[model samples]
Target chain A: MSMDFGFDMITEDEYQRQRALYEPLTEAVRRLIYASLHTDVGADAAAEARTKIEAVTALLETEQRASVPLVHENTGRPLAWANPAVGLRNAIAPPMVIHHEDDGSCWSEFTLSGAYEGPPGWVHGGICALVLDHLLGEAASEGLTQPKFTGTISLRYLRGTPLGPLRAEAFVERTEGVKTFARGYLKDADGATVEAEGVFIRPAWARDAG
Target chain B: MSMDFGFDMITEDEYQRQRALYEPLTEAVRRLIYASLHTDVGADAAAEARTKIEAVTALLETEQRASVPLVHENTGRPLAWANPAVGLRNAIAPPMVIHHEDDGSCWSEFTLSGAYEGPPGWVHGGICALVLDHLLGEAASEGLTQPKFTGTISLRYLRGTPLGPLRAEAFVERTEGVKTFARGYLKDADGATVEAEGVFIRPAWARDAG
Candidate 1:
């Protein structure tokens, strides 16, 4: 089945402008999140901070979008500013920068702070799954040229991943008609900690468009 | 084979007090996140908001925890305030409250706003995996009477889960010594959109303690 969300197409200049507008804000919010967890401020200080934060929220709410806009760059790349994985405007996403290799593989190097801990100092297993899922989907999408959705993804946690500098990589294993199979892993300084595989399917609409 | 992070045990009173202090702040940050995405405020207002947020962060930084503490309720349940899935103090978490059923199953009902969107209005697939993994782990843990780490989890996306009210439920399918097999699904109003199965493994330390 096919579905349409009516994505808008924007000029490259507009994409760059939006990027410039939102990226730093997203970064600031990310720092706020990390601070919220580690902050040992007194109750009164925290309450006052909350009030300041709420005032900022109120000011922002003065003007709002009905829904997040789905736009495509003039170069045909999808630009989703609200995506939790890699959106330039999403503070919840890790500061991941995925590198696309010439051989159609994707890899990212990033750091996880205390916010991502699951087992004590180790990273959360679900966070590991989240990163792998996105990287694998990117590999399956072939740099967004195919635009596939995650059909099935599986992960095995070999050992605990420490919450610090980490690396993840994924590559398309094979493609069968509309579905692409991809595999990847998360690694620390020592070696692989989690391995993942996924199947990504090109939607009927995208296939039809092609 | 085993590890220790020196989790502290907190009194019920302390837990309640901490909860009271942080829950509202977490909620406020959640609203801030939503507003940050939907806000159409002019650049000057947005920049001003950033400055105010930075000030708050600086105030918080005056006192900070070296790392996120893994605490346990006096009654033994893990209390991870930084958990992205169910941390009461984590703003990045969608507001979810899991209810444990007598039959060893766990379920939660929550709404995903625009911040969780992946493909336009649908929830991010990685997010589905995140929630499912946590729910399934909770089920395997049997209300934290026994602790287990996710060994492997797999999900199949049957359809898109819209970004609104959704329900997720998980239960233990079986247990084989150190491993517990669990299954779960995410559903919108109409029906199930994603199905998942997971293996939760009791660490050697826990087994030895038993």
Candidate 2:
């Protein structure tokens, strides 16, 4: 049984082209989602808008891929264009962009809009879990040079994360052979709203490849 | 301080009317997201589509709400229109419709598409977390009558959940005071792909109200 997670390898130039192409489209779609939620348009106008959206869908579907391709730069960083956490093309993602520190930690600062609400005015707890999981995974992967899958993750919600600008950071707490234990938090201006700890494991194939 | 989670109260008739209006819009936007991921249209066409989408957004925005309203039936079931898990108006949700069994368990059957992919073709681990969290929360709430917030939830990924038709279910294992312990799984055709356990806490306000 092969555990080869097929990734599309592309040059940096090609990665840039696709990113440029899809990022804005994802943004447009994101705005479309937000508008759909808050819109108070009359039924006739709403119907008209839906028709226009349907037309766009048809145009885009004219040239469709069987699946979203996960692209990796020849240099090794992953550009998973369809990833729900940080995918450049996935509108569902808050599209967190992580920054790797010299100290082997990762952090991201992003904003959540109305589309992610769970409670009336707060960011959804699951969405928080999604962001933290991705951050911890990035930390566990050690800059995406070594891929790791999340084995288990636990979160404690100390306070509600308000729907606005927020910060999340994760660091490798330790590594025991094939597994890496990492910890991180989601924060607002006051302090940590949610704290998380996760165990990420390197698959046998990845370990063997390494 | 009052912990009143301000939920808009509406009649069942109003709920039905809003559901009729937004459900199809959400479905359309969901298809738009799927199309965005799979689309391989020419640059010119993509740009043109963006223009049209922007126009639709503007039209929708002509009448907008200050925030996404969380509505509840005057009879008490939450109709969180903006919830990322089961919101009728949220395109980001797989829009899971949970079925509560007589024995206090909840299950949802839905399909995830390219938008939810985390690793190549498989469903993202964080997405699994999101789904499980919502499912377990539903169970803890006991059919949205007794509201509880997720305090801590843990997940163990036994295998990758594929981005296709899938099933998820959760049930309350026990409850001690204000805390409910629930367990659930995400499954593909074969068997359980991910298993989860969660502790959901009924807020002091909810407790007081009860």
Candidate 3:
């Protein structure tokens, strides 16, 4: 999760293209990260990683902080769209690609990898809730003109979600002033694995601005 | 979260020593990882990381899979004791160093960095629940002579948890048959930020084996 930071200065199309171009490298980095965890290698490898940090920091300093594009220029969305857990660009995202339909409902399809596992072959339960809560909140925001923040969420793990392809669907159940109620469930090939209900609030920024 | 893998074959003292020795390197790697995400460097930087993977993988292959210690051998705890979210060795864990007290309660102290941020200056709400759930489950398991898994967790975000030093505490509320009830909250310098309640189940492995 990230803030809009209101730093978007590029065209949305350009941002998307850059995100696409940069994805594979990011993924390679993530895989290597997990590999680093298991290796019994000594300080030399870790030192190399640390050494690269200074050079990278110098490159970043070249870009004026305020001028850097923080969000997608077209969508006003933050760079979190690259987050591994739910990032669209990241193959690692339980990739929860949400589609908001004309009928006031939303659904997504994605897969989980070994990285997200909790129990031997199962997706972490917290990750299940993470995807569900994000989907439900997005479902709630589909009708609104502004962003909504998750206020509370309740999750019931009916069964362990396996580490592979899965689907989820959510819809707004009701609305009372600032609160939007939503419910959803996750399913693997076998059947529904988890369910969630959430209340999302139109935060002060959205409420006051919109 | 990871499986115990039953691969722990080392003495508890050996495990602790290795954990202590390797912790700083793991932390440096983690910080570099988050830094990598934001760096605008070209292929050279990413290539350097890729090159390191092969050497690391070779070192890991040297150890026979059956002999590798995957967790704290004495406790049979998965190596995730170093996981970024709750790991003591990881700088990102919120560290959540839990202390199980004589009165049947547990508490932890930790901090959140920019890597864990969401909603601007606050820690991600899902992460807040992740820590609370883990803590509550651990608290529930304190009196039991067996392991437990999280059954259900309910969280309410009363306020955004600031991205800095924070504290969390949990205690078993009650127990019935295989279920243990626990509750806890997260606090920053100002006050409580999030509160949670959870039910943890002692699975058949813990029930039958222990």
lDDT per residue, candidate 2, B1-210, as tens digits? 234465567788877876777788878999999899778886888898888989999998999875634455564777777789888888999988889899999999999987898776678888999999999988998876776889999999997788899999999999999999999999998999999999999887667777
TM-score for chain A, candidates 1 onward in order: 0.90, 0.92, 0.75
| Candidate 3 chain B lowest-lDDT run of ten | B60-69
Write candidate 3's Cα lDDT for B88-204 as tens digits: 443334455677788889888887665555455666666777677777867887722346767888889897788888899999899999999999999987878888888888876
- The numbered model that scores best in lDDT is 2
Model 1 stretches with alpha carbons more than 4 Å out: A66-74, B66-74
lDDT head-to-head 1 vs 3, winner: 1
Point out the worst 10-residue segment of candidate 1 chain B by lDDT.
Answer: B66-75
Q: Put down candidate 2 lDDT per residue, A45-121, tens digits, no spaces.
A: 87898889999999999998756345565657767677788877888988898899999999999999989988777
Candidate 3 CAPRI assessment class: acceptable
By DockQ thresholds, what CAPRI class is model 1? medium
TM-score, candidate 3, is 0.81
Calculate DockQ per candidate and list them.
0.72, 0.74, 0.35
Ranking by lDDT: 2, 1, 3
DockQ of 2: 0.74
lDDT of 3: 0.64
